[model samples]
Target: MPVNLADQLKQQALAQGFAVAGVASTSAGGRMPLRTAALERWLAAGYQADMAWMNNPKRLAVQQLLPGVRSLLAVGLNYYVDQQQGVGVARIARYGWGRDYHRLIEQRLKRLGRWLELQQPDSRWRVCVDTAPLLDKAWAEEAGIGWIGKNGNLISQSHGSWLLLGHLLTTCELTPDAPAIPLCGSCNDCLPACPTGAIAEPFVVDSRRCIAFHSIENRDDTLPLPLHGWVAGCDLCQEVCPWNKHHAKASTDPELQPRNWILQSKPQELKEWDDNQWDEALRSSALRRIKPQMWRRNLGCL
Candidate 1:
């Protein structure tokens, strides 16, 4: 398809509720320049902590996601909001404050894929959200959706760093987008804002110090004594970005809104609940990734 046609598809994505969208040629996939080398160095320093999955060599390269994939269609959804979690209440990552993004983005991608198939019935394509073993953040930057920030998150022009990314890859040829230019030329706010100094350097995050890793991926019973205060994903870096000043809080998706109880519950209140109660409370939220015991452990931090 022509480059104009690809741009048209991106317009359609915005109309369909995506906050940011772009396209990249998968045939060109490889380890992203500085970040790739940085990832290796971080892993070598034991910076990834115990999240061994992140160091998988295949995931570090995009071509490994799908053979014969020629073009990547990247989409980003804004999840930034003005509502702050109450103090004394453990903060859940804003993304997980609502419904699971994996299911939501997947459903939308399938719809987009269906439409693409109708446009080119013979083309082969694959939809990916966070579930795939691909360097999605690099693809997002290459697609012009956003630039990777010092905190290692995609920071959008319109949405700051609070966005979710999804994409589709097709065997068909399409005009690829020039990568988004980095906007954080001289900013060091995010790097200093981190409580754990996770943003060890510009565009590089030491997962060993990342609160999100401690809250979600750390399957162990005890959180590192340093990160016990975080209950879910952390947004400290995103919150401190200057670009976010002009950003509006995203409107609530019916599915993404937190339940009344979760928004209102005190840390002590949550501690009293058992597994079944936790399950019921988090039925519609992504917090289920951490079991009730984990929630209790996190709550204990307060």
Candidate 2:
């Protein structure tokens, strides 16, 4: 059972539009204690806010996601766009400024998975996108695609943290890459940059006080004060990260570019948008996750 498909698979992933790709050997139990424990503590403290899916036991072990998984082919797509948005416009997070990222990354990953399957017909494979139970950040770090930044984002030295990640787990073995080494020795700029102090500590985010959570995920009638002009998602932490500030580049993919409507949107205009208008504007964009009520609620706060 000699296999040397890692190099070729990585090349295929790149050709499929992934910014970076790498492979990592999977642990049999697929449990990382630090991550599991941190999650437990976060949940126990009610830091997950209303996101009840975070309580899933499967999140602690990727083995539950895909039994007999042997190796993870991790891929990242850079989605950064260096466009100037109106200062008065209600802010949409960088990821939602364009087309839905889940669709973008999943389509590319499914192609990679097919390539992997063709090489090893006997291989069992599962594709994991953002909504999957797999720990994408940890696996991507283990694969050396990037290190998990203090802001809880996968930070690639070459591409910063503005990346959408996906994973393909297969029973087939591939040469594993070395784990990435974090370079944020003492830098803590992202900690205080949060308008709502969502970064509880280095890598832990408290969703309760997070503006992004309140804006997009929270369903309550009232949200915490001082949304800081964000109507959909917040990027303050990433904006302040030195790695992102200095090394981040505009994504070459035109699909990831910000929509003209979003760039010129005003709070008043968004608040006035009817459900039909909202649907038409957000048809293919990830920002559609924000319901009409949520949009008006967030806009009201702004």
True lDDT of residue 195, candidate 1: 84
Q: Model 2, 1-302: lDDT tens per residue?
A: 54668989999999988889999888743335666777788789999888888888888887788888888899998999879788788888898988898988888888888888888999988889879876779888889989988988889998889889999988888889888888988999999899778888998899888988888898888886568898888889998889898889888798898889889988888888999999999998888888998899888887
Give the range of the ten consecutive residues with the poorest summed lDDT in model 2: 27-36
What is the C-alpha lDDT profile of model 1 across 134-203, one tens digit per residue? 7788889988888887778888888887788999887777788888998988888888888888877787
Q: What is the C-alpha RMSD of each candidate to the true structure, in Å?
A: 2.1, 1.5
Pick the lDDT winner.
Answer: 2
Instruction: Identify the leading candidate in terms of TM-score.
Output: 2
- The window of 10 residues in a row where model 1 has the poorest summed lDDT is 26-35
The alpha-carbon lDDT assigned to residue 13 of candidate 2 equals 92
lDDT of 1 at 291: 84
C-alpha RMSD between model 2 and the true structure: 1.5
What do the candidate models score in CA lDDT, each in turn? 0.77, 0.86
TM-score of each: 0.92, 0.96
